[model samples]
Target chain A: MTTLTREFTKGLWDEIPLFRIVLGLCPALAVTTTMENGLGMGVAATFVLVCSNGLISLLRNVIPSEVRVACYIVIIAAFVVAVEMLMKAYFFSLSESLGIFIPLIVVNCIILGRAEAFARKNGVLASLADGLGMGLGFTLALTVLATLRELLGAGTLGLVFGERVLLAQPFGFFQQAPGAFVALGILLGLMNVLSKSGK
Target chain B: MKSYLQMVLSLSLIAVLSGLALGGLNELTFEQIQINILKFKKIPAVADIYEILTGELSSEERMAVEEGLLSEKRYVDLGLNEPSLFFVVRKDGAPFAVALEDYGQGFAGNLGVMVGFEIETGNLVGIGITTMSETPGVGTRVKEKAFVTQFMGMSKDAVLKVKKDGGEVDALSGATVSSRAVAQAMDNARAFYTEHREAILDAVNETPGGSS
Candidate 1:
């Protein structure tokens, strides 16, 4: 595989953010109560991640090492704020639902982690691919978890998609914080088993 | 010393560039963002007031009323450079009440309240919280029906201060600052309504389509 494809695909499976790397659990747990919220957050984060990654990679040589973290934060915050303004302008309801988490994206460890561990050392194109891959991976994990929780907790699918009621009664536990932890734990265990069996 | 200079120079350059980009983006989206906030936040709050004044409305009717309210924007120039925006609430194809927003300092920052006032009687129709960053369970209770219903039907000249300040308004338990913020916003609203009553009524009446 080419370097770009390798970097991109790795985020899909090998380093699938929340599940494998265990980063960005805050938003993952907070916004995954519903499928729509998870998806909305995922798209917003992807925008920020891609933009920040590309910019950081392009400026890696110019940014002094001693102040790289600060520079990265400035870039990430600008993108996050831009996302916020755009979301409010166009996707008002979704922006309302996501609330502070959209602004809090500036602090999401996933973006900073990638900037330090990958983008700072990689070329701009490679960093862009990596960001897109990681972002999509994060989106995938959030969607899967949110689908499970929403199905079990609400007995229906997303309201955005015209909620389809599946179960007559749903377990309400999966909609709360404790449930998020338990569900994440089980998913992690499941991933472990799958990885083991694959080998 | 050379490396230090580079660090400062680079950091400052990045910060300045980021600020410029954000400022420009904010300018570009400022109008749209305002419309969105009015649609999503202020409109809903006014709808809450509508529900309180006139009985409940079906979802379709509520949507119609919200749409009408958006088009009903009237400006009152309080000598504040730019004319302040307020909305008219129509009843039975006539101007019934006017809704305007005001803000007060809260625990976190500014808490916005949209208040409705009856045109003829000069009585407060109701109040709905437009925006607040108060504590979720405690300060946020100010948005609850129990807390807000207290302001319903209050006369225009009534003292809009909390009981803590020797006024009739009751403060929310465990959230004095937020409760005070609501009272303060109401005071500001009352002042605006009373001062610009003629201008507001004239603006609403002059408009062609008051029916929705």
Candidate 2:
């Protein structure tokens, strides 16, 4: 449906979770250390987002208005727990590396924000499209930041998952905390530039 | 009125479903999680120290050295189980040394340190830091590979003091508290070894077969 397409496409640019809406930042900053970690976290978050959004929308008519927030939280927390457990079982090393961040997903504002703002008012099918769009948008933002950081910091790209595509031989500072700030600042600046030019 | 009751009932049902789904997943994955935690905990301090001593340890030696690192039990025998540390000494797949990790109340909190000695020679083989939560860029310098490397081959009589105190070890810059903590931890390890020298030697003689 045209309505479904609009809802989904809006999340990709106009209502982007990180650059535009500016939600779900804790994991954004913490897990953007490596491209693999960023992608892993993004996908995990997306899975929760899509599931919670669809489920919440389906139950929107049933959930009492007074207790909607609590209901949404319970729904989001359940998805987070499921993701955390799955990661631990299959991707033990990554699960350990991500550490406390996985549990912290329960508190990520993006899932709850969509549930309340969009899913509560929208039909289940439309809500699913929005969830998918926002989730992809979040993943894209995280991946871009992480790629910039990892390439600059470690002097190598794709070093995650035993792959290497060298960009620069050595950029040691990129691997440090200060480098994280620098990369993020540049990305934000570039996003602003692109948006202004488009407008 | 009927619609309100239906809404409440539906929300309750959704909550129950979510709970059951998550509980079932957790139950399924609990064993794998436990195994991962156990492996993480068992990674021995000796392996880390050996890598420094030999520079790039063979995987087999690494495993052997880890096996040699006694678990917390040996410290229990010394009544030091309150906060115990264990070290295993290995020579060609046989454990010939036992090191104990100890923590001394330092400037910020507990300082984690390891001391290793050759059972036959009573010669201190190595000392290292495993973990510490001192002030970053300051107290953390104590755990620097350079700072810890100083403990190699030092005899029991070698006073483990910062150079400012007229001893052999250099105190970490701006982290005298952490430095002192390491020195004290070493001293405690020394005292424990001296008191239990016979048992330690006996355990070392048992070598590869001994329970670490």
Candidate 3:
């Protein structure tokens, strides 16, 4: 049980998908322009990740070694399509805002990465914990990154809830595509500095 | 030899099951998704045009929207389902502005845009950009109100070319190609409106999905 707990918690910080391990940078950069966008993306990816990881782990022994990759991809893709439908049905506005990135979640490295590295070798419960932990970590990282960008870039935060109002002066430059990169770079650099100093 | 066959059988089984699962889920969610899309994307876009046309949309118009009677959407059945889709906004049983979505060639690739125009008045109502692949700051800024606002209230006979091209419209500073692409899309939509004005008006006045 301790080992299972360790497996899950490690994904939160030690093996964080974005800053520490540096997996799935495409949606990380594209959708972090707004807090809502980043959160929506993180949630969607999490859904696909958790579902795929669980299914792959359950079928790990049954799946042929030679054709496991193809099998995993099929399973992952079906879950992604399911996630897409649920999001479309319930959170239609969010689905629209995320746009092509929703379908693009199927190609996100984190889902496939966990499926290969952890899920295939782990038990179902362990895989589920790992997927949840990694997903939460991704969501946390995105929400933190988006808070910085939205607050600094646009001057007003809490626009995600739709009760928008101006609070402070904005840099405006942070709201652009270049701004997204610069902010991400700074965050990455900060994480590096903190880890190195701690070590 | 046995392992190879097992690999093939297992993979094929997974693929077949995935297909069935997806097919079943799609059936369950298709209607809700369609309704959500109309409520979220299409209605909001149509409402924006409606407000722009009449300055303010009435409570009746809002109710019409809720009742699914405020607008009509048409995908031009050109046999192959071309990128030509349109939304017709009606008031008092008459079509005010018909919004058309069309594509035009730009420097990057195809530039997709939507333009709403007053049918009877021959006045351009508004332009809202939908899908675009232009450069981020330069070309994509065509979506910004500064560039898009230039298209409002222009007449049908008025030349749609940019200022350098000897017309009223001003090209986006560094993204002239993107601006020109939007202009060309508007031109195409206008041409389509001219050709299919009668059919579109009839469709807007009819119930939803009752028109071609």
Candidate 4:
């Protein structure tokens, strides 16, 4: 794969934001009770991540090294607010579903981590791909987690493609805080097993 | 000295540019956002409350009120943290019912509650949970009909408290924070109205299109 494609694909698995890097667990644990919610949160974070990443990378040189982190936060927060307004106006339902976490995206370490580690050094195009990759990775991990939780917790998996209810009556333990912890533990174990086999 | 000047100038320049961008975006969407919140979240609660407040009004009048048969929606600022919105449905030039937006500090975070109230009497007609960060299935169950419905027709004269601390409001099992947060919201709704009853009424009544 070309280096550019590699930047985009790495987030799919290798440096997956939630699992591989273990970043942005707060929203993952909080909003992933349902597949739809997980997707909404994931996509919202991705929008902020991509836009903020591109902006920071473009302005990286203009920002002083000592105040780079503060500049990143301001830029990220502005984008988050803009995203929040747009969501509230147009995607009202999704905005309601995501709730406080939309604003909390300002605090999501994934966005900041990218700005500090990758965006600051890379060109805008490369940083955009990285942001898109990592954001999608986070989204994938969340959706997988939410799918399990919803199937188990609510006894129905309402996939957003016309909300086809996959299972009418599934396990209920996968829906709460304790359920989130247990589910994460199992998924991490599964990841460990898959990685061991590949090795 | 040169490095410090660079740091100060660069960060401020970034802040100013980003602020402009954010401001432009906010200008585009903030109006629509307000409309969305009003039409979806707050209006439903008002309609529900209007049902109970209906005395001698015809079904036509009831439907009109439910369909936001009002001329204007008033936003009130107690000048504290942020302004809370109030919707007063007037009939025949008299205030029929009032919906007060209330905020409470939840265990997880802040809670946004819109409460429908009877104007003449302080009875709670209905409620809408606008925003909450309570844990799903556990604390969030407070938003369900089983819990919020219990407050309907509740006399605002009484203090809103959870059963755990010796009030009539039943606390959700293992979700004390969520329950208390709701109670706090109710307390805010009642206190704000009681303290500023005249001003709230005056503001809405003073506005045009509210005459009988």
Which candidate tops lDDT?
1
Model 3 lDDT, residue B138, Cα:
73
Instruction: Kindly report which residue pairs in candidate 4 clash with one another.
Output: A152-A171, A155-A170, B92-B212, B93-B212
Top candidate, metric TM-score: 3
Question: On a 0 to 100 scale, what is the lDDT of residue B148 in model 4?
Answer: 75
Off by over 4 Å in 2: A1-6, A158-179, B1-23, B38-44, B50-55, B58-89, B98-148, B153-212
Better candidate by lDDT, 1 or 3:
1
Winner on TM-score (1 vs 4):
4
The order by descending lDDT is 1, 4, 3, 2
lDDT, residue A82, candidate 4: 86
**Against the true structure, whose DockQ is highest?**
3
Relative to the true structure, candidate 1 has a C-alpha RMSD (angstroms) of 5.0
Model 1: docking quality category = medium
| Worst lDDT 10-window in candidate 3 chain B | B75-84
Q: Over the stretch B11-123, how does candidate 1's per-residue lDDT look in tens digits? A: 99999998999999999998898888778999899988988867889999999888877877777666787777788877887788999999999998899999999998989
lDDT of 1: 0.89
lDDT of 4 by residue, A107-185 (tens): 9999999999999999999999999999999999999999888877886666654443655665566776788999988
Cα displacement (angstroms), candidate 1, residue A116, comes to 0.9
DockQ-derived CAPRI band for the predicted complex in model 3: high
Candidate 3 lDDT by residue in tens digits, A1-199: 9988987898788988898988888888878877888898998888888899999999999998888988988898888888889999999878866878898888889999999999999999999999999998898888878878878776656655554345666777777778888988899999999989999
lDDT of 1 by residue, A76-194 (tens): 99999999999999999999878889999999999999999999999999999999999999999999998888888777786556666774778878876788899889999999999
